[model samples]
Target: MTTSPSLLAAQDLHVAFPGRHGAASARAVDGVELDIGAGEIVALVGESGCGKTTLARALLGLVPPTRGRVVFRGEPLTYSSRALKAYRRRVQLILQDPTGSLNPRHTVYDAVAEGLRIHGYGGDERAAVAEALSRAGLRPPERFLLRYPHELSGGQRQRVVIAGALVLEPELLVADEPVASLDASVRGEILALLLRLRADLGLSALVVTHDLGLAWNIADRVAVMYLGRIVETGAVEQVLTAPRHPYTQALLSVLPEAPGDPVVLTGEPPDPSRIPSGCRFHARCQILAGGEAERVGVADACRSEDPEVLGGGGEAQVACHWARAGITA
Candidate 1:
């Protein structure tokens, strides 16, 4: 929670996709509101199919929101091609897989220089590529310039992908599972690189990941998403140490602890097309299932009325009927 105004924000954002047999479009994302301020790192944490990645895409305008708007620097995003391109140049996306993101045929120099070409850089492209590669930790940039994707190691390949994004000198990065495919040792390197980039360049980032540990490692704030909507948001220490929402508590319980039984959740997350009414997580919530919700007199509301994000804002916000009643397990 930086006191500075938000650099990027989602205002009641929603994203839906067409369903089978011309059925009603399934809402993959439903009314997600988030904010990332200058020089701040925000992690969007959740399970698979939780719409964290889609929300990242929507923020970058790679996928248009079905409703609401994305605001950058306090202005609504424009839909025009030119405006969108400019916006994209300011906000870059870092994909999950380094192997899939890099082109096997293109040399590292050409790959890093691609963005410069697309945006019609008038200066020396080679110098820009070299600087980008250097900044991305590929020291002695010339050593990597001639190498193809196949010639590089996995860590090197990811660096190249990051270098590609860095070449544009973007203000904000929407990184979706940026280190998921790397080796355990290499994961730390990438995370450190991201932190360094943020510190050195004043870059803000929205990282989408399932690893709560990663969120704790780098993010200033963490937003926990379940079935598209954010159920809890707070400073990393606050959310991870004292989670208010049932879903957040359950998620944290699974993290490898010293001596506690992990909260094993039953059943898979609900399908997007058949999303549950009211609180989407009610069906899988252990607290609600164990009669605690009834004791708190929120059982009815948990099953019928949608719980909105509440918690007096700033560094701690939760969207749960039971949580509003101070009933977090």
Candidate 2:
């Protein structure tokens, strides 16, 4: 049967934190919107401190948004006791740091079974734990069951964290930089594991990461965030191979390439606290000059006013005015 379009949706979501009283509040997520469908993997990517983690937290209901809503299975989410409980059951988050997230004191069994116990999966806890561990590729369930987080290797510990989330049988999984702490070789293994889980269990995932290479390898779609806003989003091929936003282009320009083609960025990304007026990217954008009346469709209002996400050629949605003006062409 054809599944529904989306299992989780974040609509015009805005999240902010306290800043200097007179100054603008620290906006971590600015009017962010996206959807994750059943069995689809969406990668949220950007430079560090671009609000990927904040968006992930908002989706999980760990923190309330300043504006907009998050809907799960077509139902609006709330922080009410009943709503929170139900939400927790259906949506789970796998943190980046396996060692930090897991309890050093608890055995692998206890760590993986904690979710089950919390949700009252009393009778089936053992079976669920075994199944979860096995699913995560932690074989010899009996052997792993008694091991502590300290006893397991980095990769194994990460698998245990995944198993812990899987035991709950959540429909949507939010993995925030799950492999960030691992070695380069171990990172590939973890990525493979996640891909396998998606194929086998038919789980929908939202992976938040700063690595464009990782996103390119596993994501069906990619969303590029900057200064807490999604500057571009579309199928992986569309956004990564041929990006429209200047910011997106700047990001891709810095990626490591083949021996002949060297990657370089002209300038550094702008600071979020002191975001430039109009286009947040104008400060560092190579397309726009210092004072040339912003260049018609390319600059114009784009440099003076924030542009909303607009559907560009193909299935991509870009927030740059120049994208339509053939700047990306």
Candidate 3:
């Protein structure tokens, strides 16, 4: 199969915040690279404070990266007039908390139609609103049009937010922890809705989530991040079932397993600001200093020199010195 053109690309992206106590800034996203093709879903998976949200904001131009480039549809993105307007139309973000994202003052219809109004789609507002609402599974759109966000259930409110994004007819959707705030029962439904939208609309998605289960369930490809850097990335099945990076393996080990399976992680991940030297995971990685060291070939070099992202089988890629040293899932 031929590879589609990337609708969005982020190269060597870095985002930093002013450091406390007058020190240098804390780098939240460090030397990150990502590509979302015309109609592919790439999930950014990691533990909390791994810079997933920071990366998402960078993609939307909501937060500027300290360094690197963000290109959309072959053009460099900027916050200026024409480019900003065009970028806004092509890329939209769906926040985690629907209640907070949606304005309590506006009704559902107004919220969904707001984008159209701002973008000057005056004549087709009604039709567009109805279609967007319908596409988000809010069928019989009239029934919910006049209702407010508080009037809807948690699932319904989230769907309304989806509808608002859909109404813009964006080419790329960056959903940052979209289902994290929903009830467990409703989470599945929202996930199904997003997948369905992808299938029907051929929309590209960048899903930022801490839940590996969610990534496995909906992502076409998975990129695992740790301490602001990508450690592993590959097809969902390959990365989840046979992760190469120690961090990825550790993540999988802790996942709730079937009967008789053991947990993976030995300790908590290190703080981002005070990241470990060389490989950020050297401190917590079992392969680097555990019973598997002989078999895995994790040497002192792995701890002294950071490994570059290397090509793996298929479209997979990993950044670990011992990737080919007999490490397994």
Best candidate per TM-score, number? 1
RMSD to the true structure for each prediction, in A, is: 1.5, 2.9, 2.2
Q: What is the lDDT of residue 58 in candidate 1?
A: 92
Clashing pairs in 3: 253-264
Q: Residue 293 lDDT in model 3?
A: 55
For candidate 2, lDDT tens digit of each residue in 1-329? Answer: 11347788888888988778677778888788888878888899998888899999999999899999998888989899888988988889999999999999999999999998888885768988999999999887888999999899999999999999999998888999989999998998889888998899888889999988999988888889988888898888878888888777767777777233333445666655566778887766666753332555456676688887532112578887677666543
Candidate 1's clash total is 0
- Residue 5 displacement in candidate 3 (angstroms): 1.7
Arrange candidates, best TM-score first.
1, 3, 2
CA displacement after TM-score superposition, residue 139 of candidate 3 (Å): 1.1
- Estimate, for each residue in 90-184, the C-alpha lDDT of model 3 and write its tens digit: 78889999999999999999999999988888577888999999999999999999999889999999999999999999988899999999999
lDDT of 1: 0.90
TM-score for candidate 1, residues paired by index: 0.97
Q: Count the backbone clashes (under 3 Å) in each candidate.
A: 0, 0, 1
Error of 3 at 99 (Å): 1.1
Candidate 1 lDDT over 185-300, as tens digits, reads: 99999999999999999999999999999999999999999998999998999889888988888888888771367777889999888888889999998888989999989999
Query: For model 3, where is the 10-residue window of minimal lDDT?
Result: 305-314
Estimated TM-score per prediction? 0.97, 0.92, 0.93
Q: How accurate is candidate 3 locally (lDDT)?
A: 0.83
